[model samples]
Target: MAPLNSHSYHKVLALLAVIVSLVVTTTHASTITRRLETIPYLDYTGIEAAAREAISDTLKRRGVDESDLIARELLGPRQLSVTVPSCKKVSKRKEWRDLRYNEKKDWIRAVKCLQTKGDYGISPISDTLYDAFTQVHQTNWTDFHGNAFFLPWHRWFVWVHAEAMEHECGYSGPHPYWDYTLDYKNPTASPIFSTDPEVGFGTHGNIPLREIGQGGYKVDNGAFANLKVNLPIPHFLTRNFSAWKDWDPERHWGTALGGSFSPEQVKIALKAETFWELEAAIDGLNLTTFNDPPVVPSPDTPAPAGIIPLAGIHNGPHFFNMGDWNGPFWLLGTDWFPAGVVAPNDPMFWPHHTNVDRTFWRWQQRPGKQWEFNGLKGANRTDDPALPTDLLPFYGLGPDVPVALTLKTENWPMCYTY
Candidate 1:
């Protein structure tokens, strides 16, 4: 069994949450807009000294840095406790490609294992993405063994990449975007929230391929928490992709980045830009919920979903039976294309999901994660980076973000250090 995650994060999460309110009561007071328009972009600036300075300066200007405000935000876990399926056992009748948790193992190899494979002939992330998305397996990591035994180890590798983005690249964002589309009533189209617009869209790939995660809205993963989906996720995970493939190209194009997006492609961001231009036309639209009240956004043609079926919440893949933990599981994007996530580069990824994060944060309105709950047996606990017990303040996050409760690849609290 995996060790309990402990209230080790309590002191820290509490420091960040500050408030216990349910509604998004404040965004009505004013519109701050995206900060990126005036912010300068450093060219391919890595997670080194110069990049650090640039991000730090920006956080300071926004007043999100290490002052009392940031300290106050680090309050408590805004997580919930929905039950996910127990997928510990794989069904033998299925092909390896059809395995229930195929995505989980594949994700470990594809995105996470790439670094190891590139450096040590032990790639996992590639095997996963190629196998699931491209439908090819037989990885270089396992050679002829066909063993996907590096689950824990590869999860470690993923944390390293997340850390590089945070520590080296000045990324202070959260992980496993809280999938908002799951809530039928809280569709992102509802104007009831106040998060970065790109939250729901996915990550913006605009960052030159060379500078993928650099210079974006920084998130603090320290407060990160996810519900379990325990199903054969690769199968279930791939379902969403399949649905996109089946969608009428003319319909769900924006939701899936489909065929209509050919010439210029469609893009939206949570940064201040969308508010000033993209959605600016809908500024005066009245909104009652994140659900389908039809707020009538600007530059609006048909509703964003048009025909793509915003009917289903944006949860990962809907199951034959909806599990309580399934929403968070899908939000985080697991075992399949787990090189972490795919939206960071896509414009709509962030705001669409920030609204999702707002939903997760709002879910705290219901009975939430039991502070004393030990979580799943053998589930990963330490993988945040720099680690709290290590006494190292996380390398990349700041302003409103802190490194105190941050965990290491082992999932334990890491203290700040170099």
Candidate 2:
């Protein structure tokens, strides 16, 4: 073959480079398109917006410190739900991406106050978010998990906690939820956890010798530094990611982000045609009754012929953030991130449960399914029947609220829709 001129060879190389670039871009776009199809339209839009904001916010404010701004908010007001002015219960729990500038400040200020409220006597018991966590943690051994009350019980827990932030901590915005599935591919880097110092929750920290997977680090920066989690003996919030041994991080985008659960699973759970289907998928509960033992089904368990198997969306964030399947399962005792009892100590617990509550609220919005019940009894105690009129055992809301009242998303005292 005749040798080509230098210019001809250079031209050939340039053409090859362009072709490769097109192939790469096209492949990336196609992958995103396929993943977007799996998410429900509303969730897809929210997730995409959050992802973009995470990138943009990081770039715009990187390396700039806002500790002074945070300090000012902390010193401003000791807003507690008790003394704060009474306001209408908000019906919208907007996604993090949709929050206004002032709204973000309100959340940061309120959270900081709740964490620091230990100094105040506002909440007969320490006056901090930890107060609520302890209440739930102390009683978690009961029938809350793996039962019908899982949804309603948590719904009550998060609502009251938000109120504490609002009424006690002086925060003025509705509680926010972290849709982990939005950045299921890269949760550690999600905008919700951005290290912006103003609105961010600070990125995960380095765990000296135990940094095993994608998200194994103690969150030791931003607004939640030196947090007095798990009271009496305070501890900083930590996170570690774990998943199946054979999982391919590249192929399994959603569940791959340290959670055994996936965005596809959440989508599947949302597709539940009936309340029974939604219940089973949400908590892995037995469809017939609420008396069955909580089933945390094997990673490989399949849904029955017709019903969508337990999606583990509820269990996903728990295990994703708590269980280091590849390492020691941190469930209790030492750290706030591990175990069921103390998991709520981590600030992430509020947003995590908020997402779960959002899922339940979304299910309730399905056509003609406003008030629905599938599993057996109402309360963890056998005394309560499976009646809407039965009262939930949740306290701290002044007078005990009824199951009938808690069931409706827009009812009195309970007014918020995800």
Candidate 3:
């Protein structure tokens, strides 16, 4: 072994400092929560009167009018400022700098919040497709064209966030979508100012337009060529899930047919890789893995596992790596590269994770495996030297309302392309 020199010792000390910083940063940070918000109604006195009238009218079998419905059911008085935690915005450079060495598991957790996790301060308007922010600029901190990786990743992040929020929170509200092409002028007229440097105001990615030139994908000018290319994925969950099988509950969910799964149901199952090959036909693909750089495992495991898996860093068919789980890793990447464009407003992110949640639902549909807990007798969350057979932390679709399924749940009433 080489002898330790003063310079080497200094470098070691610096690395340790970085590690310490990351831990402190994440520990103190707060997680964004999905708080439910109802759209504003004009007045309460009118609402109650109209509500009484509408109910009486319906009972009388007379056609109810929109004005009456608006005052009664649709419109209500604005209550207190209903706010939920939104994903933390790294509004300044200092926040980003702190993330480098002190964020801990948050490096991954934050990325999830950026897109699909939760909106801290926003009132819950939960529905299957309800996403909080109306503009890409309002969604995250990473520069869109500053790098190519974030475009797809951010789109996916937003996608998963919206779906998960609706499923978990059960806010039956408007799940609005934006038309990326009508972007020259503000399409959504979002409550916030809608100016994003990446794609102007309302422009979302043109996969649909680009593919069929049908709706928003239709471009009139020479601007299409100038669109940023994030390489591997143009948008989120654009990658088929079956490719990563490490912790592929998706496959088990689908295969468990008629309400039950195999020995994989106990939590803490050791996965060989990260994802699965659930939908190779959509993009014409196969089982593949992200060419992840190694990670240092948490102290609980070996240090070799790295803080998190760079699982999203794979052959995304782009100029760089693409990911699902790996998307979270990219959010925390110190590496440098350019990503793609139109990701800021990509609507595909919402639909994609709807499918992802659909997968989670399908998993629940699998009958509780009688054999799932085989070979292991006693185990607790704190059990040391745990086996793969140990169970994991899980709950029903809604924590408020735990749902069981003869089959998994659906993202929308319409998640049946497969």
Candidate 4:
């Protein structure tokens, strides 16, 4: 061996560094692949059975025949006279992982594009077209969640977002959904959090909370890492994938609280008979378990004592993705997704909510359940009927559509399916 010159030594060191980087990256990718392989794909057949059983049991208990219910034509006539788009025209939304690498990149580009456009003039807090949607959601948080408006209102909201991206950013891809159930065993390992700068939503923020004096870890990689926003003050995209044990001590904290949105839990929610029951089951308002005799309470029944309300499918992803601080100050110290009001600040909000809408759509597809929309209405959360005449507020992003028009996904304005 000859004595090495300075230049030769530096070149050797650089080559060694590149080799080490490749090894680490390859190891990480292989670990994720193995973890995902352990989880089984979603069982659609079993899910459908559970949903039907729920509706059947409800009908049996009520002493009402399904035929009579359908004949009564409870789901009212379509409000809009526009021609319903054919199957060929309808866009199909797919799970985030299902999108090809390039498709994912295109969707991400559109999102970034929307963030650069001017605000819709809806709120002073808004600084971009993207911020405008967050503003509206924050302003109408009360009306949107914990009511009959929860499902349909969000259905419309997601549609408006996709439409905005299409018209303004020229995005031609179907809106993607994050089916948390697929990653329910270990959310952190989910491919949706891929660190790939081109396709991933970015990995969990590693920034220490003390440095920022905030709960969330600022996202520092992937497509939205450079993303900025102006709602509740401007900042970079942040996420903290903390478990929910601090928030709900009764439940064991799986990674990012994956158990809350597990396939089994979703199956239980699917068994809900009415819109309200389904909403409660999915949103974690009440009804913890259905195993022992499977008692599902009507909206009128007060939540049973001693049963801790778990953050169901809808909220599980929010809490898990954004994370929360422990103890009495939890509310004061939380991330964007957990904030509930301005959750749209994070691009992950779209796919999470899209999966939510997909779940609602699945429940609606059950026989004789398409027009079976009924739930408690108003800010008081009273037991009023969720009339089709009820209006959904969209601010300036889109038209304020009636609740009726939002029931069927195939209808005009909402010409898409999961």
Candidate 5:
């Protein structure tokens, strides 16, 4: 080989750097995929078999097979055909910890920007557009929870929040989700709660409030520490981290509050057969009374009647992070996340719910399960079918869209993926 001139030598060096960069990027991506796939999901062979039998029995009673029911139910009122949008491009959402530091900072900036923008004059309690989102949720709280709308409605809600952050605040970072399973062992110490001034959402509340009990502390560090929220009366942001407690073998599986959202729980939720079962599992509404061990409160805190021990994978993070543990009596007037209605007040709500939506998306990807939706409808939780034509009103954040449009994330308007 002839000796190369300086120009050729520099070109060769640049080529080598590009190849190394590509290799590292590919390796890192693979590692993330592997870590997610290898999570040890819980084995519930007996429960799963029972679930399948129950589904078969329900189909028999309805006098139709599963395929025929799904096909007929999906074909909603004719008007819905006019509303669905065409997909232009699909975007990938990443786990919060997977995002680069700058991406995290950008997301935080957009969220803060949203806090300053004025609302569309819809909600009396809303001081800004951000508060309006919370108001919309709070107003429809009863309708959205413990029913068919839980998963689909939240999928749309989180997407709307992301769209608002992008259009109104000029945010361009990839949508991120908090994979609670990663922090199920020790959530307070997770990077999601970092005190880092630039990227952290902030740690658990530090200033104690007597009204909210032991877990109620005003956030005192990180990017959103100074953030103030309006709705049900204005107040600075707060969080009551579920205090780490000893594991009771007879009562629960994991030690800390995070254990409620462990990988095993999520895996079991993903294994649900029907949309009803999936929603119930993800929302911590264990249908089978015998499978999950009851959560026994400390002797000092008497367990109330009808108190279900499991918080489900979806509710676990919200309850634990917001320090909304049940005691002898449930407290009132606090804006803690476990209240469910005012959960969006906390910045953590976005990523937390994003992870939830991600779980729903994962379950949807199962063979022959993408369009599997069924459950009670309306605040009454009656037997009315949750049709695709059912409207998901945005309260001026976006168009009132059909539930069908929100089903497949890769479809138009909701063109995004995990």
Candidate 6:
């Protein structure tokens, strides 16, 4: 080929640059389009005073106005100076680190108090801490999961458990939580699961020959072991340990549903930039799991690409801690730690869920996003719809608590910070 002059060579170079720019712009536009399509949309409406006027009025008589009620309800009570001279009542929930030595002791005392107390009803379930959870589980298990109601429902559960510990057992301190992300690699090794007789959740139990053969074990140690828990029948608390393993059909579960159960997963949950992504990750898709529809991921599942991942955030720690899914496991009564009706059987369920609640509260702290609730509708069943005015019915907790009022972490009944 004949050599080109400098002017022609410069023209060629400019032409190449233009081609490259067009290609880049097209690729970027496609990426934005796919992301916009894939990202789930959540229609979260702010709690309206008109919708909750009745509840607001009731709270007003107790000295809480609408805005103050809403603010404190979602975030918990605001922090005030020692001598601020205020009459507002709020419940303060603290982390484990903040508890005094005596406070820890009192917590244990309160747990024991509930453990020994009378059952709400139903004979042998009796008056123990286990019974309370069992009652709530039995009553509301249908309402909480597989919908927008999941997060708020559990938030109410945790709050009332704290209330029971305080009122029935005389615990003066707020409910404490275990931030499992801090010890993500091996949760069993953490201090929260220490062998301490007082506060620890205890280590894994002796893996029975049956369980060991099938790759399962029990959490039968620490303070929780030998502690009576009443499920269908009275039994000692149990646990088994399993490090998070990424879901792969061939390696992890041999064709079961798949995903990673790692610290990174929790971080992904916390790092969600938008509320819709956060809710989808945490609560899964708000469709009915009861029908086992094809749209819903299979059991022990993660949403495949282009599908809305259900319970993506909440599923991590459950399976990670429950570990291997090889069958004949007694604690879970199945191959895995079922996230459904019976999960609260584990005492760790409380703290694990408390951490979930904390994450929701933290997400609320983000600007322009603090006050939010699910606005989506048209599920398979009308009963499962998520509405701000919907009541989170905790049977035997006296009156029905509205979802709008409960969104705040620190409100009239609950006054504390993370």
Best by lDDT: 4
TM-score, cand. 3: 0.24
Worst 10 residues of 6 by lDDT: 35-44
lDDT of each: 0.23, 0.50, 0.24, 0.61, 0.60, 0.50
The pairs that clash in candidate 5 are 205-217, 284-312
lDDT of 4 by residue, 22-48 (tens): 322222221011111111222222322
Structural similarity to truth (TM-score) of each candidate: 0.24, 0.63, 0.24, 0.71, 0.71, 0.65
Model 5: per-residue Cα lDDT over 1-418, one tens digit each: 1222334323333443343233222222110111111212211222122222332333333344342223222221122223333456798999998899999999999998987877666468666878877777876565677668888888978987887788778898899998988877777788888889889988765677554434367777998886787655566676766443422334353545565678877887788778877877776554443222223323222211222244667666665555322221123434443333667778888898898899899999999676556666642333455543344444444444445556678855567998
For model 5, the stretches where C-alpha displacement exceeds 4 angstroms are 1-85, 211-215, 243-253, 288-308, 323-340, 378-383
Q: Where does the lowest 10-residue lDDT sum fall in candidate 1? A: 370-379
The local lDDT score (0 to 100) that residue 347 gets in candidate 2 is 68
**What is the clash tally of candidate 6?**
30
Please report how far candidate 3 places residue 323 from its true position, in Å: 18
Instruction: Report the Cα RMSD per candidate.
Output: 21.9, 24.1, 22.0, 22.0, 19.2, 18.3
Worst 10 residues of 2 by lDDT: 30-39
Per-residue lDDT for 183-218 in model 2, tens only? 766666677777666777765555532422233456
lDDT of 4 at 195: 84
Please report, as a residue range, the 10-residue window in candidate 3 with the lowest summed lDDT.
397-406
Query: Over the stretch 46-86, how does candidate 6's per-residue lDDT look in tens digits?
Result: 12222243334333333433534443332233334212122
Number of backbone-clashing residue pairs for each candidate, in the order shown: 98, 9, 65, 0, 2, 30
Model 5 alpha-carbon miss at residue 361, Å: 0.5
